[model samples]
Target: MAQFYSAKRRVTTRQIITVNVTDLDPFGQGVARHEGKALFVPGLLPGETGEVTLTEEKRQFARGAVKKRLSDSPERVPPRCPHFGVCGGCQQQHASVSLQQQSKSQALSRLMKRDVDEVIAGPEWGYRRRARLSLAFSPRDQTLQMGFRKASSNELVDVHQCPILAPRLEALLAPLRACLSELETIRNPGHVELVLADNGPLLVLRHLAPLSAADRQKLERFSHSEGVALYLAAQSDTLEQVSGEAPWYTSDQLRLSFSPRDFIQVNDAVNQQMVARALTWLSVEPGERVLDLFCGMGNFTLPLAKRAQSVVGVEGVAALVAKGDYNARLNSLKNVTFFHENLEEDVTRQPWAKAGFDKVLLDPARAGAAGVMHHIVKLLPKRVVYVSCNPTTLARDSDALLAAGYQIRRLAMLDMFPHTGHLESMVLFVRE
Candidate 1:
């Protein structure tokens, strides 16, 4: 006989418990154990005791919010941002910069089972060259809300100033907000993106509806007065420039032009250092060919081209491939070539891959280069440099290289996003 089940759920009473945090997790959460289950509490530092109320509970793990701190760690410091707790932009502002880097390094070392050779970092504040702010019209207040979202919520928090943003971009917040508030057609604005290019500042506005002539004129005047490059986006793919010239940034003395939507490093200073370090670690000789996978707009490819006999850049995006090719021509790099190919698929069968490479470099997204790891091994490059945004995937992919008799030569943590949970790392692997 089959049994029928009801949809009712169990309810448990809320309980406040004392927790002593023993460690800090990679995501900036305090780690403790309650009844043998891992308990994670945000805003609670290591060596601290707090009264925590469980916000989420599961059989294996639980999450909680600190009600009151019983003790504090010596490394704990007051957050610099006014919206630190409310704004989801930063996570480790409460912890000292040294503590933040130390916790992240320890976490990464445990994961990699190898000590980080170096930590490449830049200014802890005002390092972000690009930012995207959400826009919402408040019917109750009759005002425009422009800012980042609340932590783990869909709600928006109005931000007037952000310390992490570059100085020029931060200063434009008030003027940009005022200009947008005066526009009649901006009732339901989509979003706004600000970028500090080497040339100047650029702004991209996304709107759901078309702008009226008067509103467009006002925006144009604002752009002109502020010396900003303004681009209007009716849809995600469409961009119409109303004012200012094309924006570009220089890296390794090479000027690369990119669209507002192009993906570039958020921190410019660290990017230059990272590029130079990658070249040094690879030790590219002028007589050897190099392969750069997931190369976006030739950030590394063009630089590698300067040092290698020939360089081939493979990207999945067609527009980026075009941009990479355009940048190569713009820089008069004759030996570098860009190809649009799906990296997840078998790239070894491609014509460019058949030519082989003396060294290889790849900078994959958070998902990591799992699909292409085996391919790199099969290519049997002399040395391989892997730049990863996700440590878990990097570790998983590193196993493939290890299995193929490749050993880690160097590993360094890139403090790409400071005061935040995000960590970037680079590893050099050489054939045993």
Candidate 2:
């Protein structure tokens, strides 16, 4: 039945109605009732009355857009960014911080059918360490416009400042724009990435054409003056080090370095807390063998190695596996090792899978670890910890684990991203 619901649903004509919001959906939209159907209203909160236009109609539920707010909830607060309603980066800025966290916890608890042990939160603003801002040439103003896309629209929002960015990265927005304006070589620029790494700030410029020497000189001067590392990517795989060194960030005692195109958690504080919590929940002892699936660059592998006797980190990307090995050696952790293999496959026959891990840690991408659970069951790990970014997938995978004789022992909510609908959670399952 749940699988059927996950499949595509039919839609019909759009309608407009006044609704009294009763709850919030997983996407942070307000839920209301109309004609025996639940309607989802964007920009509306529970305990509020609003008029909405139904944008999508389905059998189970309907989706709508807020046309007017009749009565606002007490938890509503004015958004900090002037571009809040326009920028696509944030959705729940109008909601108070406490309300946002509460809604997320409630949503996750209901999905997992388990009580949340704790809610891990961090600073609500200026906590974003990474951002990708869209770039376009504005012919009307004869200037380059760089910002997030307009909410639900392809148009780019011209932004001079972003409050959600870290102080250092925020300070560079105007200067970066000024530099881009002066560069005639940059035409129809793809986008710009601002990453506030632990070492310093790094900017990745994506462009179609190769950069000229003059362009490189100008960018080099900008890097030196602003104290930022800059990289240019003509294509997805073609990343050129235009200036400065590759950026690196430290997780606990482990230092992991990567190219600008690589993936890294956007929030540093929450990531550290998550790592600490995961290790604590797993309780990897000195002599226990552990397996970390989808372990990118030893975020948890190196830290776990500090306590475990031998730790194996497996990932699909060979580059990340190499980086993880380097990070382990850089941290002087000899017990840690990494393997590059597709985790979705039957990895039980793999050499690393034969280690007979006593404990396991999984941190898969948004798709979640589906078929991998079968391979994991073969290892007969006593304890399993899952760190998930999507709740629906986590719930589906939990069923698989339960069938394999593992019961959920602990669950916690992670507010990795604030003022957004994004949800990340950690769950511990112990063999019964």
Candidate 3:
């Protein structure tokens, strides 16, 4: 027989009830209840009394909005950014800074079904190290606009200044727009990446077609005068550095290296803090063996290698592995090595399968390394640190670890993407 609740269910209106939100949902929505049914209130905080109107009704839950705030949390403060709510970039802007951190912690606990603490917090603002923005140019109006998508639609939200960005990076929006309109035969400019280094900005433009000789020359001229290292996305998923001396670039401290297409954390300030937190949680001894999975350009691998006896970073892409090796050699890191192995796929048959390690660090993408987690649980290290961008998968894998006799020791929420609702969390476990 089929599952009892798997079939289609009717959609009907239910009695709308208003209650004080007391917690956060897995997706960072505020939690309230009416008639004992869970209500997800977006842009709300705990201890806030609000009037909620139900829009949809489901069996286990419903979604609602605050029509009015009857009372506010003592911790509440007005969001600093103007693009608050309209832009999909941040969700907790309506909440106070302290509550944003607490919401993330509570969300982790709710999702993972485990206890987590809030012992650590990263910088509040000016933390974003990298950002990607979508572009839209209207030929009829000869208009150029670049920003993120709106909250519930495919439309782009026009933003002149982002409160969370480094002031230097935010200052480039006007000049960049001026330069784009100078192009002769441009149809569409899909995206622009604002990569911030210690010196200044490295602007990466995603052009839908090849730039004419004149536009290319103009871009080069702008780079020379502006001190902005200009790069052009020659092909889809390809980044070619044009003005910078090196084909590959370095992070602010050069602690990590990245290619144009390779993924990097959005918030640089939070990233450094997160990496440090993982290293602290691991507590690497001088001779401890550690494995870094889904390691991108030795972000954590190199730092972990400094303390550990030997560290091996394995990635799916050979090019990234090569770059990681180069980064390790350039830094004169003697104990770190990198290998190309697809952690997304079943990696049980790899050459490093049997080797034992004292600790393991997982820095997978949004999909959350489920395949690797299965293989990793077998190795059974003394400690495991999971760096996750997605909480649902973290919860799923944490459940697996719990079944295998591991207890969560510490957890933290980093506000990597400030104005947006995106969450970054770190969890540590010790074998029970």
Tens digits of per-residue lDDT for model 2 on 13-49? Answer: 4455789999876567888998899888888999999
* TM-score leader: 1
> What's the TM-score of each model vs. the native?
0.96, 0.95, 0.88
Over the stretch 95-171, how does candidate 3's per-residue lDDT look in tens digits?
A: 66666666667767778776677535556776675778888887688787778888788999877778777777787
lDDT of each: 0.92, 0.87, 0.77
Please give the range of 10 consecutive residues that has the lowest summed lDDT in model 3.
1-10
The top-ranked prediction according to lDDT is: 1
Task: Give RMSD (Å) of candidate 3 vs. truth.
Answer: 4.1
Q: Which stretches of candidate 1 lie over 4 Å from their true place?
A: 1-12
Shift in Å, residue 232, candidate 1: 0.4
- The global Cα lDDT (0 to 1) of model 1 is 0.92
In candidate 2, stretches whose alpha carbon ends up further than 4 angstroms from where it belongs are 1-16
Of the two candidates 1 and 3, the one with more favorable lDDT, higher being better, is 1
